[model samples]
Target: MHLKKLTVVALSACFGLSACQKEEAPPAAPPASEAPAPARAESAPQQPVESMPPATATAPGSGSNLIREPVAAQEQPLQAIQTKMGPKESVIHLTSAKVTGQILTVEFVAVPKKRGDGRYEWLNLTLPLKNVSYIDDATAKKVSLLQDDGEAYMASPLNGTGKSIRLDGHSPITATLKFPAPPETSPTISVNFSDIGSFDGVPVSR
Candidate 1:
């Protein structure tokens, strides 16, 4: 049996547990310091590699330090669901689950209902922090996030620079997570998020 070996760090664990419910809900209007900067124009994202190093943190005012751009999230997800994250009502959209070589990349977006202030607040989607994993429908085995040789998770980091990944209260938040490829016989899996719920029958593509 494959164990759930990805240990959630204290800071990340705080975002996933109910005990930190208060922290999950951002302020009605995000503080200016917490706002995401404008995304600089860049070349289209290159194909993903088998592994990637953790993003290096820079001075607080510097922009995002994400190593690569994620695949553009689709206008429509393969599946979507509504759920509550703390006091906020949010929708989780599962966009794509594609296999490339030995890696399976899962992309999703989190859309929160506009706060009374009419602005979205930051939402943390750091995979490792949330104990995100998936179960193969065929074998009933759990698969954890892929990590590099140095043991750093290959998923996108918080805000692309922080210790954990956070979605700025820009528009909806899109996140990509990498995992080991599933069994050849399995064409779908159930993705499990810590405090968020599980999404089953999620189709897989090669």
Candidate 2:
């Protein structure tokens, strides 16, 4: 009888304690991500993308003319010389190379080729770089390929140079061109080059 009485008292006490305890509310849900494109987020700096490389070509003659420019001993033996807006003549070996006012001068290295009899031929062709195909991907408003031939050719008139070209019969060139600035679309000027002739007194086929 006493055990039964004690059990009832304990149950009554637990019920009383439970009635005094407070209930907790559920936690708030996470904020939705439908965020508006914030203007500068109040305070954050911007960043730009960037990778670049410099480029350069050889001059008219001498060590850089051919022998040492590309690699080891000169490969092509200079042959005939032809010009589009300049002079055309049977040029001998490369005599001398000099850069003046940005124009590279290639003087006859060998005695000018002789006529059937004995006279020499005058040169007339300008180096060819105009036909070089390139694509202008720069921000420059416009881009152009200046041809030594007295004209400029562009892959796209609004803004372009050349995307690709086959200057050398077997050498296909593909590249993107970059210009300095505006209306001067002519991003760069250049010439087609070849060196197939007599080297060190030996007649070599071009």
Candidate 3:
């Protein structure tokens, strides 16, 4: 009977020890997808952005970085005499004068007098002739310049209106005369057209 009682006690002790070990065991591991992620490193501070300089604007139609300059005034032409001449009411009008380098240009207009028939009948034709014989022809041939010091310069036919003198009584004939340049210091000069009077006190300019 004692042997039977000792066997039951030993079996009871073994069952109690197994139940305590089961209660003290660790929990089961979680799945790989449900695991906690690692921490991220902190980002560096942002740097300040640099600004560019503004570009300069230039004038329209001008080169870059260049300023437009003002233009200078132009040289003006010289003046001349405008008047009548001769007893027959012929006229000689000086329009302008210009000196360039060594040449002198003189622009003028000449009007011839109307002819009368023996102091009675007016010889004025019904139609003005395309070409007329007039006193300006003599004037053109003998036109000259008398300087302040009495030095005379003849008209240069090569550079001026040659021997061709056209006269129309209905309207004045415009002509240009070229001459050798006179001394710049000449205070005054006279333009003489023989049988057609003279233009005195013409001031000289360089």
| Winning candidate number (TM-score) | 1
RMSD of each: 42.0, 23.6, 20.3
TM-score of every prediction relative to native? 0.52, 0.18, 0.36
**Stretches of candidate 1 exceeding 4 Å from the true structure:** 1-87, 115-130, 159-163
lDDT of 3 by residue, 92-205 (tens): 676655667876666666555655642322222121111211112222333233222323223222222323333444544566555655556544455555445556555545
Decoy 2 TM-score against native? 0.18
Every candidate's lDDT: 0.66, 0.33, 0.46
State, as a TM-score between 0 and 1, how close model 1 is to the true structure.
Answer: 0.52
Q: Order the candidate numbers by TM-score, best to worst.
A: 1, 3, 2
lDDT of 2 by residue, 1-206 (tens): 99999999999999877765533212222233334335455334333211111122223345455557675434665443322221233333333323334332333332334468655554322233343222222332222443424344322211233223222111211222222222123332222223332222111111
The list of candidate 3 runs beyond 4 A from truth reads 1-82, 112-161
| Cα deviation of 138, candidate 1, in Å | 0.3
Judge candidate 1 at residue 55 and give its lDDT: 29
Write one digit per residue (lDDT tens) for candidate 1, span 16-130.
6765676766664576644554322222233223123222334422443332223334434446432335225566677788899989998877776677798876554433344
Question: Which residue segments of model 2 deviate by more than 4 Å?
Answer: 1-91, 101-103, 108-192, 195-206
